[model samples]
Target chain A: MTRILVSEVGPRDGLQSIKQVMPLEAKKAWIAAEAAAGVQEIEVGSFVPPALLPQMADTAELVAFARTLPGLNVVALVPNAKGAARAVEAGVHGMSIPFSMSETHSIRNVRKDHPAMLAEIRAVAEIASAGGVHFAVGLSTAFGCTLEGAVSEDAVVHLAEAAAEAGAQEFSLSDTTGYADPAQVRRLIRKVRGAVGDMLTSLHLHNTRGLGLANALAGLDEGITTLDASLGGLGGCPYAPGASGNLVTEDLVLMLNAMGLDTGINLEKLLEVRTILRDALPDEPLYGFTPDAGPMLDYNERIAK
Target chain B: MTRILVSEVGPRDGLQSIKQVMPLEAKKAWIAAEAAAGVQEIEVGSFVPPALLPQMADTAELVAFARTLPGLNVVALVPNAKGAARAVEAGVHGMSIPFSMSETHSIRNVRKDHPAMLAEIRAVAEIASAGGVHFAVGLSTAFGCTLEGAVSEDAVVHLAEAAAEAGAQEFSLSDTTGYADPAQVRRLIRKVRGAVGDMLTSLHLHNTRGLGLANALAGLDEGITTLDASLGGLGGCPYAPGASGNLVTEDLVLMLNAMGLDTGINLEKLLEVRTILRDALPDEPLYGFTPDAGPMLDYNERIAK
Candidate 1:
């Protein structure tokens, strides 16, 4: 396929960064709108505990609602075996468990060590296989870590191979702290892709360093077919202070379509989805260039088959 | 110099599109504050008649005031040979006269045909030579024309060569209607650079097509050094309802700086200039990303020499 599928992660990745927590039904509406916009897959919610991340407590309900959509693939983030069990039982199309390469980052983000994370990946994979849900491992800090600094690409590639061996069917590289440049991105992605082979490799990038889209472009140039973006530039990193984490979905789709790549997403309808999220979280800021710039006169319309 | 010059043209290109005319003195203050922010070059006003463009009556006075600033390259837009003469007399560092290759755009904008417009460029060149001032030619509608549609790349390359031959020290490609894409930009820039070499370079782009930054990135990849932007994403063609012209200067510079391309601009200081423009033209809308999303903490300190 010439068109790469752009999966929006605003509700899950974007919402938790900001202080505002969207209600469950409002999230369902947001997911429904994004589904209508032809977003092939969406990370609907995270399965983090309510005490830890109050913003994403409605994962079970939201995933079930998203699954009802005809062609939409519902995805969820699971931190450990418990969240993985919930995601698999809730019937999400795909489940991703994060593995931070940096030992320090693993402790800070998940309260687990590297070996514990690897064991948890095996647990999540077992749950996914039994429940018939897709299993993947997201290697955050695959490029560089904010806490420790200078994550080697060798460790990242080694981790991907480890996750695959642990029964993870897919692999993804994320620039968790956004320290990636285009050159670094090309080098790392090439290395990772070569290691992972064709296990549906993808990227989950944050725009913390403002290299989000540029790094994403590098990934695309390296033959990556799956990209994760938030509707607005809603990266919302806690350490980042008033910044959106993921690259802006609208801007990324615009870039892909304008380059003659088939995204199968309508620019106008996708922007309309922004209004749905805006209504739900009125205080949270939404960001993207294309919506503000408006669609070009010849923006191709998308037919949701 | 390795530093690229990003000239802000919002007060002129941006305000002229609005029905309301921003006060002349406020316009001057905007330029002044922008210069203070280390915006070395600012297109303070356009040299159009008061009846046609009542928004910019005090351009000559603005140019004079802008010249008073230490180490700033003050610029003005000259529509024809007459505006060039005034700009030369006012003693601005540089001025640009827009030449539309599209016959329909030329007729609608300046009420002249292509051959006659060629005569006007010759006149402006002679005036600049006598008055001892620098003159550049901006070929507007170089990408495509709204009225005539699908402007030929050959036509743009030829006009660029002719402008350079007629004593234009610098030439800027105008995507007056924002009809440029990245691949198209790489192709056309390569074609023009082949024809006119370094003399035919610089980009005056619009984000109307949502491809402004992408087109700019493509231009940079092709070794383009100078970029023209308006402050606050201001400016549109009054005749063309939805057509905004000129990429937002602050946002574009932010992208370049974040990419480690030195533009000799401090983002925080550049952001301060937006407030002056916003206060001056309360009725006019200004657009920029970096202003809303504050600059990275060590950004200026890290980049500063």
Candidate 2:
């Protein structure tokens, strides 16, 4: 059976987009439950300053807690070498940084342009390698940007090549604005892989336009091995109100499991993990079709059956 | 550009699933607006008895109204020869009968077994041929069923062969319970096509499991051109509450339009059509991610770009 890595991103991407800060204990429980449900990797939090995103204030603590779980690969997002050092000190298994393909979005999001972002990626790579941590560069807004509109595939390929040359071990095309379609995904994956080879291994997708899973399938067709998703479709894009931001992890897992691909995750236990989120953030709306519809009849017996 | 036929089924499939009967005028206005937006085909309604589905009582009137649109191909669903006769008299461009693959679903949905349904298909095919109307057989529950889990691909292929031999002009694999995945869709489309050849041309998919668009993409990859969708995913499955039913036309068109496929739909105008449904069925909820998120930045310019 072909194995696909479902890297849970609810803790970092999902929580940062929402204003509510889940209690630290709740975050720990959420991560623990997901790990127990056979999630092999989790982006537990980001190393961003608490003042900007209080929801991610517990990153170091989460790293500490998640490391105790056997076989769980803990990941954290970093903005630059400064944050990368903190993540490494906290002993995360992997660290990733956002290098926006749209220069305008980059300036607005991280106050850096192409050159400065590459420099940061270089510096972060050095720190991560020294600490024996896996490093990945996420090309945010690689699809299309709200501020800049259509991003060219050539530009995405160029940035990915630069990041790889700058010592980044892996790269992901991030659909920050949910502007990607299946054709674009296939074309971009092939284009980026042409530029960076096997380093282009992951896709960070959004369900904003309801094409998230289809886009993921396209990536899979192009041999992408890792997929990023949130527990629920939480952490919606601030630019697009009433739109789901992250692809719901449960929905993605259901599709993967139904396809008979080895995702390692158990559907029932993964679904049960949602209750922890529900209790932690009562007012926040959770999104996913599988959770609402329940699984197909005899779902357990049908996984990769 | 590859032209794909996106057949709108909101007037029939969507309405029948919901309790509220959309005012007839609203339905006519909706169809007219969609046709004006460059939608070429629409399943106006089903020719069921008024007492059984009062919601579809005005199907003949809808067919008549829709046929008047210069470029619109008006279609209707029929249960058997009796309904097909009414549809042909109403001057429909096409009429389709549901031939369920699962015996349980066949008996429950249309009160007919395989032999009885094939006889009905034969009768309908004769009437359709006499009237010079296109006839299609929708293999309902071609995917798994609520009562019977994991439907066999061999059974579906066998049924498609029988339907074609019974004079059915075209066939569609219907995921009535939304128990379809991309792998199953790709595999079944191939298997059924091997038996029925080009007669297997359409897919009637549901979004009950949120794999609707992904499944549609798989069908497109397998050379199936015609896809059935509802405006706003209005007609939800009765068995799965809080889960969307039919593939949302707005979302599907958005994906197709983004992939540069020629769906001939002006998405801006298509999104506006949701208002008619919103007004007509005030109490019922509408489902779709595109309408809620609005279109991607510069979406109009991005169509088939």
Candidate 3:
């Protein structure tokens, strides 16, 4: 079986967008259930101020809990050096720092411009490396920005190069506003890979434009291994108007598994995990076609055969 | 711009699944508005029994109305020689006859077995050819079937060859149950094309599994030009439990336009047409991401630039 890594981001990304806050215990349960379903890694929480996002207040605790799971890599989203410090202290397996390519979104999201963000990347990389944590810089709004409009591809590639040079272990390009299409996905992945080579690690895409899986397929065709997805299609950027949410993990796994690529996920178990989310976040709407349509009859038959 | 054909099938495929019957005038207005938005072809209706599907009782009228529009290819779904005769007399540019590869789905959908369906194909093809109407065979359950599990690739290719031999001007494979994945799509298209060559003309896919557009992109990558979609993702098989509907047109055009593929659609105008459907079929739910999230800021920016 050809292996692909599916990194779950529902706890952090999905929770951050919604108004309802899940209890810390429920978060642990969700992570445990998903990890049991064969998710190798998960972004358990964000190291942001509780004042800005009360939803992520339990991120550190969640990370600690996530670490207890065998064979599971725990990750956290750190906005800057302070967040990085917290993440490193928490002893996470990986930390992702988002670097918005759009200057306006950069300021709006992290209160920093490109130069300032680059400095932060270097600072966090040093802290994470010293603490023996893997560091990745996510290029948010690399496809396009709602606030700043079109983000140039050259600028995205330049920032990827800069983040790599700043000592980051890996880089990811995000469709922060779900502006990515397959051609752009192919073009940008090829462009960035050409510029930074092995430094490009994963893709963070949204289904906001209904191209999430299409974009993921495009990434896979270009040899990308890691995919950032939120279980139940959990998160949406409250800041980005009209953005739906991240690619639903169940649907992504279904596509990958059907294509004969091994995600190592037991999809039936993954879907069962959605019940935990539903029970914890009762009012929140969960989205995915597989759940709605049920598994393909023939796919199930093939498995039985 | 590189060109691709997006054929609308809402009238025949979408309306057939809904119980609410749309008035003839509303149907006309709907088709007219889509044509004005630059849809090159519209499957106006199916020639099935009025009692079986009263929603499509106006198919012949719809086809006649569709022909009044300049540069638009009017199509109708014909289940047998009777439907084909009506389509021929109605003067449609094309007629699609579905040939199910699954034995069970073949019986359930059209009440005919493989041999019987093939014979119908020959009779319809002869009638259509004499009338100068292009005849295409749609291989339903080409991917898999709810009634019959695990449709074979070899069976699908063999059926395509049979349809062509029976005088089909073109052949199409449909994921009637939305069982297609990108890898399966690539493999099946290659296999079928190797068997039927240039006779393969279109793909009829569903978003039932949320892999609709991804599957379409896979088809495009394999050199498929014509895609069958429904405005607002209308239509679902009442018999096929849990299936969603056809691929949404606006979302499909948005991805195509962003990839620099010329769909020749004015998306703005296309979205406006949704209002007509909404008003006419107020109770029917509409689906598509581009309409919800709006166009990509960069894509619109590029259009402006």
Candidate 4:
């Protein structure tokens, strides 16, 4: 069976973009249900300051709850050494740090330039390494930047090499502004892998331009094993106007299973988990096409017989 | 330059699915605007009786008006020999006859089984050939049918062979119910091409499961030149409940352009045409991510510079 790992990031990425806070109990239930649906790994929450993002204020608590689930790799998002320290103490299996490729976006989002962010990544890697936890540096705006019109390919490859050298276990290319196309995706993934080799691990994509799944397929064609997606496409970029949230996990799983690659996810069960999310964040608009149209009859038959 | 043919089917496919009828003048303006935006082919309307689909009643008149536009291929959707005769009289550049692969869908849609549909296709081809107009047989539900659980690959290839033998100058496979996955698309296109060679001309896909553009890209990879799409994703399958309309022309063009393939379409002008569509059919929802998020700045720069 061709296996692919779908890393769920709704708790951190999804909740951070929304205004409403999902209560702690609902968050726990959501994570448990998703794991039960066969999601192997999940980014439970982000270790950001409560004042900056109250929605993710319960990250430490959520991580503690998620770790109790059997056979689940509980992950968290960290911005700096402080966040990484908190994540390591919380005993997360892995922690991801965002490193922006665009100079303008880097300053606007995290108030740090490239070199400063690289130093922060190195510090976070050191902290996570001391705790014996896995570390991944997410290359944000790796495709293109909203503020800085075009992000250079060389800049991205250079950063991947730098991050790998900084003791980062893995690097993930994120279409932070959703400007990625399939050709660009294939080109960048090949370029990064050539530079950093096995250190380039995953892709975090947004459907902002409707190329999310297409771009994901390009990554798959390049033998990418890990993908970051959210349930119901939960998060939108608050800073980038009209950008969509992460690729919908349900849709991604459906496409993978249909392609005969094993995601080990029961799509029907995964869709059922959407109700829990909807109940927790009632006003948030959920977006996905598979749940609406249901699976293809042929796909259901192939799996059944 | 890599060129792609984007065949606009919004008038026939889009208007047919909706309940509200767009006025004749508005339909003409919509076609004219799209043609001006560099869309080469326009499916101006269908030849079905006005009583069956009142929205397409002006198809003959629209085709007449569309033919006057220089370099624009004025196409019409025909159901049988009668429709083909009318289409030929209208001086259409091309006429497409839909031949449903699923028996249940064929009867429900046009009251004809495969054999009967093939006979009609023969008749229509004869009429079209006599008039010096091109004829394409659209294989509806070529992916899978909602009523007929699984459409076998063998069944699709068999029909393509028979259609080629029966005198269809072109055979366009359509995912009428939107059940196609990328792997399935690549598999089927390769199978059909192997069987019929150049007889397979285009792909008509739906974004019902949000895989429209993905499937289209798969077809493109197989060197299938033509693609059928609707402006703003205007059409839906009335029979297939919850199935989305055709692939959005604007989004498809954006993807093609981003991949460095040229469709000769002006994205900004195509968007402006959406306003006319919106004004004419105010209640209808226009779907596409490009119009919402706008094109990538890098894509704009690459195209400009």
lDDT of 2 by residue, A104-167 (tens): 8888878899999999999999998999999999988888888877887788888899899999
TM-score for candidate 1 (chain B) = 0.93
Instruction: Kindly report the docking quality category of candidate 2.
Output: medium
Pairs of colliding residues, candidate 2: none
Question: Chain A TM-score of each model, in the order shown?
Answer: 0.93, 0.96, 0.97, 0.97
- Give the interface-residue alpha carbon RMSD of model 1: 6.8
Candidate 3 lDDT, A1-305, residue by residue in tens: 67899999999889988898999999999999999999999999999999999999888888889999999999999999999999988879999999998989988877899999999999999999899999998889888888877788888888888888898888888898888889888888998998899788799999998999999999998988999999989987777766668999999999998887889899999999999999999999899988878776435455343
RMSD values, in order shown: 4.8, 2.1, 1.8, 1.8
lDDT of each residue in B1-305, candidate 3, tens digit only: 66899999999889988888999999999999999999999999999888999998888888888899999999999999999999999989999998988888778777899999999999999999899999999988788877776788888888888888888889888988888888888888899999899788789999998999999999999999999999999996666555558999999999888888989899999999999999999999999988878766545564343
lDDT of 2: 0.89
lDDT of 1 by residue, B180-277 (tens): 66656777788888888887668888887446766777787678888888877888766544567568787787777755677877777777777776
lDDT string for model 1 (A173-265, tens) is: 877776555656677777787888877468887765445666676677778899999998774556433434578898888877766678898
**Relative to the unseen true structure, what is the C-alpha lDDT of residue A134 in candidate 3, on a scale of 0 to 100?**
94
**Native contacts retained, all candidates in order:** 0.14, 0.71, 0.82, 0.63
Question: For model 4, how many clashes?
Answer: 1
Model 3 TM-score relative to the real fold: 0.97
| Candidate with best DockQ | 3
